[model samples]
Target: MVRDQREIPVRDRLLLAGVQLLEKAGGGDVSTRAVCDLAGVQAPTLYHHFGSKEGLLDAVVSHGFRQFLAARRDQASASADPIEEIRQGWDIHVEFGLQHPASYAHIYGRVERGKRCGVVAEVEAMLLQALAPAARQGRLAVTPADAAAEVLAASSGVILTLITQPEDAVDPGLSTRVRDAILDSITTGSTSPVSSGGEVTTASAAIALASTLEDAPTVLNDAETALLRDWLGRIASPASSGARI
Candidate 1:
């Protein structure tokens, strides 16, 4: 059936503006008038495009998820190894969170609870599909769906911590550390040998190494530093065995 495309651009602009405002002022500050003003459209036009403020927010969330999923899918498609694909997907997710913190948060953050947007289900399905090959190849220890869910959820926490916490408060290698910890947790028998000095565990060392990668530096802006430290503080203390390294 033929469909009407009358307000596509207007709707897109409103959604984009909503995302920007939501990031700057938060979800509660998002209103039809605000989004309309940001988009340079009138309130009536916004209503014409989106039935209500909630509808506009939903569209914004869905659009953000679509873009995020597409970027990850593209990155995975470019790589042949399933493990590398998964790693790249995580990297893309982190990049997205860092670059578009508001949009990413809108999709996965606390605001998503009552909204119940369908994007989460869609993204989850895509993630599960991506991990299927690894599970089938015995590269990942858990079921494909379970592994995907765990990795996705853990990555979300890592990204949120990185964005929300202050940089100086966290170890310089926080992101790398979290990534390695997650990787090790998901892959059975993939643990690295422990260090003798014990100044840091194997997982921590791996995180340090990962952070030093030419691309992933240890440097952080003031805000990032604060966020990092806060995130580190929130992590549970090491067990008597001291974190599986």
Candidate 2:
């Protein structure tokens, strides 16, 4: 019987190749054949390991999420203040997006449209865990889960825009602005005057604008209205006054 001489595990080899292909051609251009050539493995080995090109993409996204989680955890550990922690977290997220645009897009950009991906939940879990202390201390305005989801979505949008924008485009300061905006929005009515009235002072105005929109029957449905009311109530309570949201 003939035996394969390739000593490396097929799965690992394919994943390594996928990473290389992603680095070279970006996630959208990666192909099974390209990965096979990079890994020095047979086409059958690629299929045996990842089933399909999409499967390989999923693996790449998962791997990127792991790296992202590690970086965020490290950043959070180095920061003592919740506000600084959130700022550092956004910086790390943007850095990852800029550094690994392909992987970042694969994980956050395409996965939502339906892919064999599993990284979103993991990333969300990490975000919630990091924000838990802030939520308890009233430094954040919403439930830990809601805050995590909002922050993740908002930051992902900033990163995606940064990735898709033209290279020569104006330095919109989009990431920093968006990060500070989110923090301010969440902490709008809080006791932290600095977070409340700095350059990001528009957060409170933004909330007021959103509230006005919510009050419009044309804008909000019953469920949406209830959700907005609940959110506002939590942030507007007298006990919550001066409390960091």
Candidate 3:
């Protein structure tokens, strides 16, 4: 049974209105008047709640995107393989984009120079969390932060490509191929004891040590840990040690 929209809170009603309008418009621009009319609230109410139309849209997109991720994260079973977890994350992101192109575009497509939405950081944080175990296991070829950046770049690019193409023309395997290529570049399959070349590079050693120390408790105090991290940073620097890849 469909509950009455009147029962919903004012703010949520506006959000739902905005989302509905965006979907109905096929990701096109949604007018503030339409949103307010759909929500059955005055224009002043929207401004009072969200400051402006863009603010309302941003809130809707952010809330919906985060909620989807949280639900999926909770539903997923724990996996011993962090790499597999990252792969699953990639799939979830692509699935969200394909299923909700309008919402996905609202998050990714609208960009201003030198400005990034908080949702971008949220996405990166999710990937970073997935990468932490891989880093701790010394499977990451670069720092976890770098790995997350690469993964986000590739995943977003693939999603945008797929979303923009005609549905019938979209390549089914594009996302998988790109994801594998990016992951292969940023990760390795061995512990810090030995990489593919049979010797652990200094950068890999520093990354593994830093990852391990960052997550687990240590004998050193906070300041000492900071200093150790600084040293590790220097060790991992491409200038000090040749570039990782």
Candidate 4:
């Protein structure tokens, strides 16, 4: 098997070596020579395959994120409740970081706002999918996009903070507290479309009616219905405090 690895393409060997280093280092960085030595490849071979150290790091990060998403995909498929599944996702995300801090940090610890990563975007897309069923049912307080953004920010921040501290010194409730609070702000606690209020939440009411209108015949034409749906979305939006449907 070791000889088989040595015979594989240089890029694959480099990724395997980098992942091994990340596991051993616990979020610390490695030198180019270390990766080259682990792969039994020359420095020129590494550079030729990856262009630069940063490029190799990017590939390694993408690889780790892909594996993370794959596990999440299997879990999601076996579950029926979207809201509960979303909460479970938060826990899974934190657990992954604890298990592989170095690989996880490369994917989420950075503070770059404008940069684009396809793997990271896929994670957010999955979150949106989890939230979609609730949103369609008028159980979401905010748009799926807004809720996803909040979840991503809070979960990543909590993991990064935990990884920065000694494992035993970290607060046990921090991740759950942050996750639940953010979720409450975006979704009704129950699967029911309505909140504790008399009928339904204002946002949910508007959203439900809009969806009903979409399904049934209406006096409004296509253009009017489209505009009305847009207006309902804005009213349901958390950022639009004064908006009316």
Segments in model 1 whose C-alpha atoms lie over 4 Å from true places: 1-8, 23-28, 37-52, 68-77, 112-116, 167-172, 188-245
* Pairs of residues at least 3 apart in sequence or in different chains that clash in candidate 2: 138-244, 139-245, 140-245, 141-245, 191-242
Candidate 2 overall lDDT versus native:
0.66
lDDT of 1 at 195: 29
lDDT per residue as tens, model 2, 1-245: 64453776778778878777777767567767788887887888677777788778778767876777586676565755666777777787777778788887667555444443566676677777676555544455445566678788998888888888899993668888888888876653454433344322223333333344433455577787777656766655444444332
* Order of models, best TM-score first: 3, 4, 2, 1
The superposed Cα distance between candidate 1 and the true structure at residue 68, in angstroms, equals: 5.5
- Pull out the clashing pairs in model 3: none
Candidate 3 residue runs with Cα over 4 Å from true position: 1-4, 70-77, 191-199, 238-245
Instruction: Count clashing residue pairs per candidate.
Output: 14, 5, 0, 0
Encode model 3's per-residue lDDT on 1-245: one tens digit a residue.
88798889999899999989988877778899999999999999999999999889878877888888888879887777788899989988988888899877777777899887767778899888888877766677788898999999899899999999997898989999999888777776553334434345577678879998966899999999999999987877656444444
* lDDT (C-alpha, whole model) for all candidates: 0.61, 0.66, 0.83, 0.75
lDDT of 2 at 211: 42
The runs of at least 3 residues in candidate 4 whose Cα sits more than 4 Å from the true structure, single-residue gaps closed, are 32-37, 40-52, 72-77, 108-110, 116-119, 193-199, 205-229, 239-245
In the range 172-245, model 4's lDDT, one tens digit per residue, is 79999999899888775555544333234667656556656744798888899889988988777666533333
Tell me the deviation in Å of residue 4 in model 3: 4.4
Tens digit of per-residue lDDT, candidate 1, span 1-245: 65343445776778778888877864244667778787888888877887777678767777776777676666555765666677777777777777777666666565534665555566677777676554434344444555678877787787788877776674436666776777666554432222223234333433333223323545687677667644433332233113543
Q: Please report, as a residue range, the 10-residue window in candidate 1 with the lowest summed lDDT.
A: 190-199
TM-score of 3: 0.85
